[model samples]
Target chain A: MNIFVFVKRVPDTESKIRIDHKANKIIKDGLNFVLSPYDEYAVEEALRLREAHGGKVTVFSVGADEVNIILKKCLAMGADEAVLLKDDTPETYDGLRTAKIIAKVLKDKFMDYDLLLFGRLSIGADNGQVQTMVAQLLDLPQINVVTKLEIEGNQGTAYREIEGASEKVAFSLPAVLSAQKGLNEPRYETLKGIMMAKRKEIPVLPLEDLGMSAEELAPLMEVVNLESPPPRKAGTVFEGEAEAAAKKLAQFLHEEAKVI
Target chain B: MVLVFIEVREGKVKKSSLEALSEGKRRADDLGAELHAVLIGHELDELAPECFSFGATKVHVLESTLLSQYSPSGFSRALKELVEELKPMVIFFAASSMGKDLAPRLAAWLNVGLATDCTETGIKDGRLTVVRPIFAGNVFATMVFKASPQIATLRPNVFPLVDPVDAKGEAAKKNVEITEDQVKDAVQEIMREEGSELDVTEAEILISGGRGLKGPENFNLLRELASILPRSAVGASRSAVDSGWIDHQNQVGQTGKTVSPNLYMAFGISGAIQHVAGMSSSKVIVAVNKDPDAPILKLADFGVVGDLFKVIPPLKEELKKIFAD
Candidate 1:
């Protein structure tokens, strides 16, 4: 029951996001990067599966050198191994292109895996396409936004949330599942685990080594511009009796807001 | 022609799909392209008239028993066959849970690019360009496809649904071949919450609570207010969800659902950047909190510096009176 979890490093959700209009990229100065919150659930699930099934949990991430930090964090949280599929290209945040590279790597190597895991979406680009694309490329069964998962023998059952209901899906081994919130509470790294993780070196595989040309790996989607949403102006604040404030707010909504 | 994929649940078309079809109609008119709709399932031709009223000039029904329930492989394969045959210029899908799951698989099958959760779409230089919120609505990225049959998923409730008008249209039924082997994943059951309340993403107005709600039992107050308003739903902040005070489906924030409703009323919520990222696109925002300096007060169109427990009763009464008029 070998498990493969794909992880990503993204700017902390609390951090202020600023765009570099000249470069058409995000400004990286003085921003604290952390493992994507959703991916934490994936890594935790993988570790638990490995513990119960008596196998290894290997984590994969495709990004530049900065991504290694997240890979190391996964190792600190009890992952057996970490691999970085390095991408130094100027084109950033293409889900299809990234999926192609990963699919190629998985096809060429690591053919004996029984499970593939991914965070539902990365916080930065928020595409939520790569895992499904990878699953399609590899021709594997997939279930996204899974909340509860159970594995027995060579089969797996997962419960995924929809708008007003939850679907119970069953699939065979070698399937892909994307983690959503409430999957599980991820554990923090222990002192011993951190010390052991610091001594491990993650192997890096460049995109060029995957035998795909720049044109083949090129992004099919173009980013025209990146900018902040229009600023929202702060309107009047009523400070006084609760009843008066409530009445005034209702008046504003009726005449000015008119939402009701 | 532009193709819009329609999703049906329990024989009824989803509201988000209608919204996507309406948007597709607008884009199709702008580009002078025919608007067509596709539904992949059994016994769906009966729903074609609804699609026509919304703006689809033609509805393509890909009927297959294997596709009666949604399997990522089965539905994507069926849609893939249709796309290859029609070769439409573009494809549109509502960014619902089904759309989020199926569109990418189809895009991958065609080896084409897809933009997800787009807020705006139009023809630019004779190709489709879209605007999508990235970094959780903190920033907007304008995107364009580099290949033919450009695909995108429009965010639910963000796009306006047009009034249905009678239009001359036809439904073309095709029998798609999908074998049992192709659908390795099976849906055993669908567990719906009692009464099937509206999802927050599709709600017109939201009554959201935060830590100030105190406990899980306090959520009933928000639910009471939501019930009083038409097309309203309850939402929760990250703190409230993290504390096990509510379900994740009701959570609205960066890690939760991004919602753009007509009116958003936040109670006892001190806006964090992540939470604000989800609701900033809301049309009108009002906040009630005892803390005058809560960040939500700054972003809200109207702020009340008072106790929410005290304010909500009067607020509900005032709203009831206004609606009575």
Candidate 2:
């Protein structure tokens, strides 16, 4: 029962953004990067919790070298392995130096892992607070965003959703959840799972060749500029009966859009 | 300075934290500094005179009982010790669900610079300049913060909550020591959840629907015109909540819930930029949509092309005959 997950590569959230004027930022030429639509619901909820609790699912990222083509597309949506923490100008929308470089590249693989997953925010910084800030710098036990998950033996639970209800929360078995885009519906990779993810295996490292440091994960907070916005002004067509245009749109929401 | 956290929950105050306390008193009076706010949980002295009627010149208070249910690592360690003793410049919070889980760990323990959900803000020579809408609003990003304690998270009814241009609650606060043993995220109880009472941005009327309201029991005809208006609330879109016909918290655009209510009424909804990023700062967006070129009718301000079962039961019988005359 290992898990890990954590993905990232961003910038293709339909990239039409520009703003580089000498590195003020976000002009990453042409765009098209992927693998972060909220980490495909945390790599499909860690491949459906290792296909209903059996074991194995790994995955990690820091990116660049085109994040090995989105970690082989999360090894074709099943993830039994992959690491990729390369880093070369991997300024990754700086969410706390990308969660202190995924907590210093998983601080000694967090005691061989028991569970750690993210993706409840990150369309390149939608900020779902980095899997509870890497479970608060590895102090652990975080259940955030969830949307559902179970497990029994070591007691897990999850659920989350918050703000208009849905909590559940139970935590125990080496936690850290996050995952949230409706929590499931991810899949998409078939063709016999893309011919068995073209023979699995993803590895690749370089957090100072695994020893780590880039100022032990730099970035206090950046992105001085990234731009793209300014185009919203043409609207005013209220014609005909839908109850007489809801009465001149209820009198333009009450006298020239005063909003009732 | 600007600290504004204020999220009260079942005890009042949270019309998006009074638009994050009037955008943290307009970014602390646009950097002339000082505006505080903060209010964590518990009885909160009746939402502290409505955070001094929304100009919170100052008002720290951390009200405990482990801040009665809710612990994003104990509200980001009581806002990272009041942002290390109020080193604010900007720190709005209220992207909801507890400022999207305590504004990125209080901007990663005050290292600074953050821009979440934002949806427009400006300051200029003193920085702040926010505006955020990505992927779900189809793109619009404009950020900045070279530091000076800049942190944002707004996006709840996109600003508009003034009231006390500073009548009393003057500038000068203190009480903020927090305990429950300086929580590290342990609420061992409360899984309680009773939600559902139309609060899409404090609903001032909203009755959304989409995918032509063909399933999930036609969302009770958009909840019968949101139980007959008077601060309505029903919403849908994201193709009727991914076609389950509703319940993705009654979805709405841009990854849902960005409502600007005051009359949104979109039925058989066709709009999609994730539902116009949750309502295009709504306020009169009426779109009925029989497909008069549906892109939520270019952010409607009024465009009933036609047919939500003949336009919502005669506009819910003309709003129950004008609130019964």
Candidate 3:
């Protein structure tokens, strides 16, 4: 078995997000970048699968040069190899364009892989479209938001959470699966693993080397403007004993809000 | 034609689909095009009338046992055939789990652009433009599609479901073709959580907790409150779910569930943007936290600065009294 995992670098969840309205983009200065939290689950699941079934885990990411930091983290946590699909252009926001580039690379280079893994959704764009698009491009079976998975021989079973139900689905080998929460607990990188990762070299693949031109990778959608959400005004705040506040709240619900 | 996919579960239409229908109808009127709906499921003949009442000019029904449950390959192939024949100007889907899974695959199959979880949609300069949240709902991105039959998935509860009005034209039903072999992924079973309790997305009132609750045992406080309120459900922030204090199904956030309950009450939640993206569309929000500066309080319609342990018990007691009377 061979596993390929896609990782993304995003601002830490705790970091404050600021929008540059004048430039129609997010302010990247002074923000801490880390591996997307959900992708950590994917990386960990890949390592576990390697342990269960003899295989090598290759982690892939597409971004600027700074994305190597996240690739190193994945390597330290047990990924056997890291590849960076470099995209330094301004048109990287289009999910389909990104998916097309990845599908091209996968087809040209790693077509023999048995499985592809991805986070259920990237926290930064929240698009959740690229992995499925890639699966379609590859014409392979795919499942999203999988909570539980089991593989035996050439077949695999996955459980995905729906609105109020869970669907148990089975597919053959050479498939795409997105990791949801509860898939597994991501382990922290150990000292020995970190030291070992320092000796590994990550290969960067540029679009030019992949024989893709800028016209082919151009985005279909343009960002009209980027703005912060309208500030939510502070509503009336009550300060008093718990009982009095509760009474006032109940009154407000029944009278003003009329929700109760 | 502007086509909207009417999602059905257990032989009934979903509220999110109704919302998408309403939005699609508005967009169709703006474009002076007919609004059509497609229902793909088993035993869906009875569900077409509701689609007509909700403003579908024509309802397409593709009934097959293979589509009784969602399979990416089956539904997308069925819809792809319909889309290729109709050549619709736009397509709409609810950004639910099933819709999120199906829309992109269809878009990729058709080689078109797709926007997911769109909060707003309209026609600009003779092209469709959609607005969606990015960076965990902290920033909004407005996007335009470059191809015809542009596809978009709408966030549930973001659009209004207007009253069912009489249709101008009778809804014509058309049968679509699908084969069992088209569905590559076989469904072994669909296990629903054993209960009659409403899920968070379907609940009208939601009481959610965060790490501030101290521990998993404290979730009982929220369950107690939920029991007292009508059609209420308990929810948790991602931190609580990550801490193993609650089930992921009960988690409400960017990665979890996006809910727009009638009233959302947060207990000890600091209101991270990821969590806010899920529940910000609720009709009204009330926050209770010890810290006066919690981000949730800023978005809440009402705030009480106090310890949740002290406030929740009394609050539940007061609500129980009112209901008893």
Candidate 4:
């Protein structure tokens, strides 16, 4: 049960995002970056799978040196090894190119694995395409937004949450799966694990090592512009008795909003 | 020509796919091209009329016994073959669960650029440009595809479904051959919810509850409120869903589902930034909470400062009367 989990560092969901209008990107200065919430679930699922099957879990991420923060965190969460594919391009919003790089590495270097995992989507780009693209590039079976999973031998069954139902899917081993919420409650890093992770050195693979250049992995789309959504106007607040306010709200919805 | 992928579940075309067709119609009109819709499944020719009514000039049915149930490899390969033969100018998909999973694989197969969850798609300078919400609705990014046959997914409920017209269109049938060896993943069964519940992304009105609702049992109040409103679905904040008060499918937040309903009613919700990013695009918002300074109050078009439990009963009663009239 060799499990590989793909992770990304994204702005904390709680952080206030400021745009750099001049560059058509978000201003990252002073913003807190954390492991994407969905990726945390993926890492935890990898750890659990390793614990159950008695094998190793390795975490992989593609970014600049700053991505080490998230890789270290995953190591502290009980992953056996961590690797970083260096891409110094300040902001790479192309999920397809990223997927291509990861798939190439998996094909050329680490071809033997029981499972490959990813978050449903990266929070910053919110494209949610990389996992499926990687699966296609590698010609492997894949499932996304998985909530429940069971494995035995080389056969795996995953439950994907659809609109109003859960689709049960069965696939062979060496498949790709993306973790959705409610998969499991991720374990907090123990003090001893944290101490060990602080000293462990993670191997970094430069893009050159993979025989790929930035130009070859150029994005498929260009960001023309970015703007903040218009702020909602302040509305009248009804502070009277509960019954009266409720009635007033109904009246407002019927008359002013005209939604009813 | 523009190509739109229509998703069918239980032999019925999904409303979100219709929304995608509506969007494709607009793009076709803008580009002065024909709108072509494809349904890749068995016994789907019956659903072609809905596509024509929504402005499809032609409907293509690609069916195979192996393609009856969605196999990521099978469906994507079928669509890839169709795209190769027809060579449409653009491809559109609704950002539904199936679409989200299938579109990227097709894009990779075709080696084309794709924009996901787009709210605005149009022809600018004779090329496809799309605007999609990124960072959970905090930022909107305008993008231009750099390759031929631009591919994109439109967010549901954000795009309006055009009025159905009594127009006729041609239908083409093609039998796809998919070997069992190609379908590496297979769907075993589907466990549906007890009732036919609307997905939050497709609901016109969303009645959402939060931690202030107290517990899971209290969500019945929200269910009752939703019952009073037509085309309404019950939603929950991430906190409520994380607290195990509701299913994650009903969650509306950055980490959950992003919704742009006509009206969003947030009750007992504190409106964390992540939660706000999901529903801020809604046309109108109404918040009911005891704390006057809750962040959701500021973002809502109507705010009621009172105990939700005390307010909900009267609110439901008042809405019932209003609808009764």
Candidate 5:
């Protein structure tokens, strides 16, 4: 069995995103990028599956050269290899196109592989749409936000958290699975693992080399504006006894805000 | 034109689809394009009337036994076939578990672009600009797809559901066939979870506890309140869940379930952005924390500054009185 996990290098979540005061775009300087935490789960799940099934796990990413740092983290966590789809990102791009480039590059390989996986959603883009789109492109069966998994022979059972309930789904080999956080406690890079990761492979597959055309999949949307949410006013305060506070709060909702 | 995937589970429509339809209607109107809906199910004609009420002019239904249970290949094939034929301007899917599985596969097959979990969307100059939180809701990213059909998945509960003034409409019958090969890999069994004492995601009202309740026994007040409110459920912070005071299923935060209920009551909880991201969309948010500086109070519509041990029981009693009367 083999597992391929997709990863993305995204801006750290806490960076104060600044819309260039004049350029009408986001300023990319001074920003730190990391392996999307959700994808971390994907990598961990793959490692866990490989541990049980006896196979190699390959991790892949789509972004600039810096993305290798994030990919290396996967290797450090015990993945067998890493592939960086190196392309200088434009000021803006779509997840769907990202999925296409990934699918085009990995489809043939995936056909040979037993399983393909990704994080439930990326923390950077926060649009969990890419992995699913890739699964669609590959025309493979996919299970999303799988909470748990078990292997019996060639078949695997995926447990997904559905609305108000949990569902167990079984799929044969060669399926796509998107993992949510807490699926497993992603192991940290131990001293031994870090030393061994240096010997692992990190290959750069150019988008053009992969034979995917950005122009073939024409984009449908463009960003006219970029800005952070308006800062909220500091909240008001109230001090009093419990019963009186409750009465006042109720009065406020009913008479003032009318939200109750 | 916009193509919205209408999710039909167990014969009826899920609440998230209504939000998708509403979002689709707005996007279609903005783009000056037709708003079409695709419903794939085992047998879903009974849901046609409901789909139209959400502003779908045309309903494409693919009836098949394979769809009775979810199969990714079948869903992707059905959607890929539709996308090829309809050539929608933008595609909308709710970022529920099912949509998460369906959207990417279709986008991949079509060789298009997609934005997932878009918190906000607007069309300007024939382009769809989407905004979403990044870095675990630590920052916001405004982005655009440089791909066709502008496929994007909207997070459920993030977008407000619209009640169209004249919502009544008729759906034209759509005859589409779904083959067994299309829906490969079946969900053989569903290890159904036991009935939840509090699942805030689907609840109309949520009572979430934080670390301030002091002890697990203190949750009695919150539980007592939930029993009387038929639509209410209880939730807790990650701290509470990890503390063994509550189940992880009841956790509501960045790492937990996001909810937008009619009412959200926070007891002994400080609002973290991760915490706020999950439930800030609620119609009304009330917090009862001892500290005035609690983050939860910043966004709350109503605030009660007091001790939870004393505040919760009387508040529950008052709620009982108001509702029982």
Candidate 6:
């Protein structure tokens, strides 16, 4: 089984995001970047599949040169190789253009893969569109938010969490599956793994190499404006004995909220 | 025409889809276009009238055994075909699990732009603009789609449902074509959570706990409180679910479940933006945490600084008394 996983570098969840009003962009200074949490699960699932099925796992990402740090982390987690599709444009591409680029690369450059893995969604954009878009672009069956998966021969069965229920789906091979939480616990990189990762070389592919032009990758949607959500009005905060606080809370709920 | 996808399960239209229909109706009226609804499921002919009452000028019905359960390929293909024939200026879908999975595929197949989890939408300069929360709920970005037939998935509960009115004499119903072979992915079964009631997305009141509860056993206190509140459901932060304190189905956060309950009460949850994104739209928010500066308190309408163990027991007792009265 040849498994390919797509990873993205996003701001750490705990990082404080500041919008640069003048520039109309997020200020990246003084911010920490990490492999998207959901992508870590995707990389881990790929490694586990490779270990069980006796094949190589290659990690791929679409970003600038700074994404090498995240690719190295994937290598440390037992991926056999890494590929970075360097975006020439300064602006972020929408899901359609991004998926098109990835699909082109997979179809024209790395054609050996039998399965593709992706995080359910990236926290930055939070659009959760690329994986499904990639599946559609490639005409491959796809499942999103998969929590449990099993594979045998050329068929796969996946369990995905829906609103109040779970669904069991069966699909053919060469499919795209997005990893959700509870799929499996990702293993941390060891000292030896980290040392080995430093020695691994990641090839950065340019848009020209993938037969794509800058204009072809332009975003379909334009950002009009961005603003911080208005702060909630200050409310009464009780600081007293547990009983008094509870009594106060009950009174507020009944009188103000009126849910009771 | 502006088209809205009316999601149905077990032969009933979903509340979120109704909200989407209401949004679609508003946009259609604004654009002076007809509002159309698409219903896909087995035995959904009976539910088509609900769409008309919700302001659909026309209803498109596609019934097939293959569509009884949602398959991304199946639904997207059918919808794509219908969309091509209809040539709608805008399409609306509820940002439920099925919509989130299907909308992107349809957008990609049509080579159009899609905005997901939109809290607000409107027409500007004869184009569709959507406002969606990013970085969880800390920042809001307004986006405009340059492509024709713009697609958007509206967050549930954000839009008001249209007041029920008499059906405008049965909407013009038309049947779309879809064959079983078009559905590539097969669903073996849909396993529902045993003895679970009120999914967080639809719950009117939610009582959520975080890691401060100390252990999974402590969730019983939340359950006891929930039992007394009508239509209330239990929710957990990602931290609690990650720590195995509760099932992921009950998780309320960016990656878990986005909800807008009538009232949301957080216990020991430090309001992470991820958690806040899911429930910040609650009509009323109450928080209890030992730390005064927990992020959730900033968003709550009422806050208490105390240990949850001490506060919850008494709070539940007080709530029982108030409700009893």
Number of the predicted model whose DockQ against the real structure is largest: 1
Score candidate 2 by TM-score against the native. 0.35
Model 4 pairs in collision: none
TM-score for each candidate, following the candidate numbering:
0.98, 0.35, 0.95, 0.98, 0.88, 0.96
Candidate 4 positional error at A29, Å: 0.6
Give per-residue CA lDDT, model 5, range B1-325, as digits (tens).
Answer: 8988988766678777889889999998988888888888666877876777778887887766667777667777777877888888889998777787777677777766667667788997898878865544444567777667787778776677877554545554444476666665666666545657335776777888989988788777788878877778888887888788976668886667767677788999988666776676677788888888787888877777788777776776666665665
TM-score (2 decimals) of chain A in model 1: 0.97
Off by over 4 Å in 1: none
Candidate 2, residues B110-199, lDDT tens digits: the string is: 556467777778888876777776555544566676565777787776678886653667433344457654554454444444435645
DockQ-based CAPRI category assigned to the predicted complex of candidate 3: medium
- Per-model C-alpha lDDT, please? 0.91, 0.70, 0.86, 0.91, 0.74, 0.87
Q: In model 2, what is chain B's TM-score? A: 0.34
Give the TM-score, chain B only, in order for the candidates: 0.98, 0.34, 0.92, 0.98, 0.88, 0.93
Which lDDT tens digits does candidate 6 get at residues B40-62? 76667777788889999788887
Kindly report which residue stretches of model 5 are placed more than 4 angstroms away from their true locations once superposed: A11-18, A21-33, A90-93, A108-111, A198-201, A214-221, B26-35, B119-148, B158-175, B197-199, B214-220, B242-249
Clashing pairs in 3: none
Error of 3 at B78 (Å): 0.7
Give stretches of model 3 more than 4 Å off.
Answer: A213-215, B168-176, B317-325
Q: Rank by DockQ, highest first.
A: 1, 4, 6, 3, 5, 2
Name the lDDT value of residue A172 in candidate 3: 87
**Ten-residue stretch with the least lDDT total in model 1 chain A:** A87-96
Residues B1-325 of candidate 3 have per-residue lDDT tens digits of 8999998877679989999999998999889988989988777777788888888878888767777777888888889988999999999999988899999999988878888888899997767889988776777888888787889999887788979986554544555466666787656687888652678987889999999999999999999998899988899999999899988899988778778888999998999877997888788899899998888888899999888898888888889988998
